[model samples]
Target: MESETKQSVYHSATYHAAGEAIMSFKPINEIHQHLCAFHVYSSDHSRHVEAHHYCKHLSKDFHQCVIYDSDDPNARLIGIEYIVSEKIFKSLPPEEKKFWHSHKYEVESGLLQLAPKSLVPGAATDIAEQPAMLELHQTYGKTIHTWAIDVYPDLPLGPPNLMMSYIGDGQGPPAEMVQARDAASGQDTAAKRELRKGYLSSYERVEAADEWAKTGRGVEFVVKEVPLKK
Candidate 1:
């Protein structure tokens, strides 16, 4: 029964953003399925959250965490919690960094605020080495900057690294143009149809990877308060 309630709140909490009437709203088992696919929970499933926007909301109640050697009995979970008062992420002092040197944990903030509906997709998932069905870029004046990140749970094995792709305005690439690219290199899929289903094309990939990393098996998942840009 407790599990059912958790699922209900997760769903209604999401519709609050879609501007759908919530008066008679109720959670459905399908809610978990959607979250599993999107890796984020937003008002509308179509919009992706941007960097500044993501930081603003997620910092309110979320945190950045690290996971250490799970095989060791004394492993720890280190939290780089949102320090609103400081306007910067608060991490354990240098001494604590020693322990954080190794581990694997993810953004623990709830879905309500971490992943917004106004930015790009794949905030927490890895991208393929091959051409993407869609290539999204942000324009800053006449210069077009491509903001891309690889969102895989298991990775190069270290701290998270941010990656970027660039395209110029006018000459900039189409956001939805698809090309042949290797998708099997990672745990995510390569199907154009499956990739483009939600608000953001690559949402399912990220969500699934995040879930597998945390539970070792696929489980309904959600994340909040992760910075879109460093």
Candidate 2:
């Protein structure tokens, strides 16, 4: 009697209809474009995380990138980075603008890189030298890194950290870290630095999110005095 009841439910009209509905629905897979990889540091510049960006171009002036910890099969969702042109950036309110960071140093210094899995040796240098990247140089990104994979490698811990783009000279990830990445990916950052010299003029350095912390504008920083016990 139990077997018969189970068989009746499996053969029911509602079950068949549900299965048919699921089979008829097609997945939308064309909206995402796998763009590149970026090595990002926290706002305080204490930790570094490698992010792979899969972007969806919303319009000519804006793009939304979904950042992953890596492109491997076991990759984890790390964060999201939103890119906007200078026109859109300027349109934002003063308080809203404080959350975004400019891409000037990231582009000129060859810190923000394209995924090497999709490129051959020296190809990234050629791509960076193109006029297209110059547009990115003027853009701003607002990134929020949810997973603290760098500090807590075993698992994500604590609250989500607001990530910022590198703005100053030698402020990006360490040389050894970047060099090791380049070796595995077949990218030559040193050579790309040379090729990107002429394009430096196109980069317009803008105020970054980190600066907001200093002036107590957008996000307030509070200090607590703790007594030292001997």
Candidate 3:
């Protein structure tokens, strides 16, 4: 027997489908690309999350992704990542720059790649294009994960945390983590690393971005006493 909650959920889902059948979701419709990468907290690189990005390309200068832990139907919507061109990253205020992390390391290192196109997770023949690599190689991302799956697995407790990318050699995710990501995604990080050699190596990095890696400083949110706005 279906529980009341389950029955209500089915009804609500049907209503949502009916609404979706008529409505034009311009933004959602615009999402055409998928990517998978690993992210670590700015304050703690040892902790990591596998980020599955279903991205919408808003413009040449900006793109944003709704991230999840996996591509499974029941995957949790972990958070979002806002990616911008180098020019846009440079335009940010000094204080604002700390939150955005650079992609050069992730790209050149082959830790980031386009997700497989087919339904099969580890199927071959899904190749990442160089054009995609070129665009992301120099971009910056501001990511924040609302759900702390690494900590409180059952709940999205605590304040949201900013995420950062590994920026240099010897600072990447653990070898085991990479292996697991590879196994799940059918990616060859080693081969990718070799193939990506000299690609975008000459692209100058935006110094202001990835401040945590640059200066060992990062931002964190904390509750404070403030009067509520009327």
Candidate 4:
């Protein structure tokens, strides 16, 4: 029997229905300590429970609070996400700090493809005209990185705009793909895949949701304390 607790679902291509529960996290600071010990974050317990649930899925805790600081104190809780697990935090490579920037550009460009046929025909045409090398680098760079990681299970690579279009394609031709190509070429046979573990200490200015479009804090992130729900 289905448990009384409502289960959240994430969209995936492999399944006709929901894929899995969305992962979440919370802070590991005083507020979290208070809540676990006292069932409150210096604010109303009911309001922030949902937000807490969201982060709890990611196996972290909320630090300050976003719920109580809003103009309407009684509003359902929201908070700036801080304090991720060491596993996720370390995933942000010091050398690859610019990854998010490149990824942002790549994602934005891909989204443009969804516009009407008349929109930016020149841009699309340029992409279509670009040499095979440029297209491969731009399209499959992230996939290569993802695949190189042993910690993550294999992932599918297809149209960037649609991440869920295919699966079981993780083992394809190496000449046409970086991950497969690297594995096949055997240039770095001894190069062990990096283990991914760590939290994302970066702050995204807007309230984050499950959509891919919601990443990246527009400008330099200003530290802000998210209060608990009232």
> Model 2 lDDT vs. the true structure?
0.69
By the TM-score metric, which is better: model 3 or model 4? 3
Note the Cα lDDT for every prediction shown.
0.23, 0.69, 0.84, 0.23
Runs of candidate 1 with Cα error greater than 4 angstroms are 1-52, 57-159, 162-167, 170-174, 177-230
lDDT of 4 by residue, 114-221 (tens): 111222433353343233213211221111111211122244232111011011122111223333322322322112111000111222321121122243222222
Best by lDDT: 3
Runs in model 2 lying further than 4 Å from the true structure:
1-28, 31-43, 128-132, 199-201, 208-230
Candidate 3 residues 1-230, lDDT tens each?
A: 56988999999999999999999998877888888899998778778898999999889999989999888988998999999999899898888988998998898888888864343432232244567888899899999999989998888999999999988889868889889878876677877777777455578688888787657776777778898899
- Identify the superior model by lDDT, candidate 2 or candidate 4: 2
lDDT of 2 by residue, 171-216 (tens): 6577787787778767777776677786557545555444653563
Worst 10 residues of 3 by lDDT: 117-126
lDDT of 1 by residue, 1-230 (tens): 99999999998778776656545433322121111111111112222211211112233323222212121334232111121211121233433221111101111111111212222344333233111112110110010112211232243333322111111122112223211111111122234224334323222221211222333332112335776785
